[model samples]
Target: MKTLQSTTFKAIADDTRLRVVNLFVTSREPLCVCEIVDALRLPQYQVSKHLTILKNAGLIIVEKDGTWGYHYLNENNPLNKMLFTFLKKYLVGEVFDDDIKRLEMRLLLREEGRCVVGFVDEKDLLIKIKEKKQELLVKE
Candidate 1:
């Protein structure tokens, strides 16, 4: 049985890992690693590293669909339930809020009825960001 005695605490001990947990908790939807990178504005490798730690710690679960993998909170674990409850009630800081906001924006990039634009490189993201900005400017 997975226990919170070590891995769970270690997983969330890092600020970035904790933020990633909060992202999953708040969204209540499995998120892809690319979406996480875009939302946190962190490098892909860094986010993937955090994700691996979380997965190893049993704090998150991965679901694979073809080439895409989505990460979700391991809600079935009792320890995770307690931790998520605490986080949902108390972790209302600006950084988490900002992640959620960016996550919402990232969702907007989806091609309607599909998961996000699906794992674009940094260059692609930059181009998309510029296009989005232009669209906003035209609308305003």
Candidate 2:
């Protein structure tokens, strides 16, 4: 019942929330909370806090599978989809670029389309991403 237009606007007003939205907006598959935490380079608590706000605003939904919860944008609502379209088109800059880069790299750690590694430290995650990129480059 809280699908008020103002609710969505308020939820997305924070820069961090926008970055979270960007992840769900652009991702091909639902993301684990750990993935979002790694991508945003923030603590799990902060990411979870933001996720709670987004969920309350009805812009995203989370589905639990075993011990993990996969989150995706709420495309069921036209407004939610419209907001994501705008984020995809207009969210730009180094911060946004870095977020996407980290996420795409983190995704490489997935096993059989599911996140197997949880809560990697920032430095190790970056190094792994770089190494993975190098491996892909060598193969090509």
| Per-residue lDDT of model 1, residues 106-125, tens digit only | 76666543464666554566
Q: Could you tell me how far off, in angstroms, the CA of residue 133 lies in candidate 2 after the best superposition?
A: 10
Top candidate when judged by lDDT against the true structure: 2
Ten-residue segment with the worst summed lDDT in candidate 2? 126-135
User: Residue 28 of model 1: what lDDT?
Assistant: 84
lDDT of each: 0.81, 0.86
Score every model by TM-score.
Answer: 0.79, 0.86
Top model by TM-score, which number?
2
